[model samples]
Target: MNRKELEQRLRQELALPYYNAKIAERDYSESEFQEMKAQLQADIEQYARDYVNESNANG
Candidate 1:
């Protein structure tokens, strides 16, 4: 995807987990909350890598 597309995708991808994480803080256990947070971080890293690789390829 292009940079703009990537930005939009990243925004959508990251939003739900963040919203859930907010709710999860109250409902999920400590380990569960940590897992959710870790997954979000992983998702972010993967998206960054994909965006970089895609951008490089497009260029």
Candidate 2:
């Protein structure tokens, strides 16, 4: 997915109000942004694995 879509998913998964703001107003530091990106990537990978596992189990 694109950056915006990823951010939206991350926001939902994180359930944090800080992520609900507009990108420009978020004003996160470089390190913080990197950390969030890493977390998002990890979460996405985990979700993919879960989906595959669930599908296999159901199939």
Off by over 4 Å in 2: 1-25
Clashing pairs in 1: none
Candidate 1: count of backbone clashes, pairs at least 3 residues apart or interchain: 0
lDDT of each residue in 1-59, candidate 1, tens digit only? 33334334435655742332223113344555456557777987999999999999999
* TM-score of every model versus the real structure: 0.57, 0.57
- TM match of model 2 to true structure: 0.57
lDDT of 1: 0.55
Model 2 scores a C-alpha lDDT of 0.65
Give one clash count per candidate, in the order shown.
0, 0
Instruction: Evaluate all candidate structures by whole-model CA lDDT and list the values in order.
Output: 0.55, 0.65
Q: In angstroms, how far off is 15's CA in candidate 2? A: 21
Candidate 1 Cα misplacement greater than 4 A, ranges: 1-26
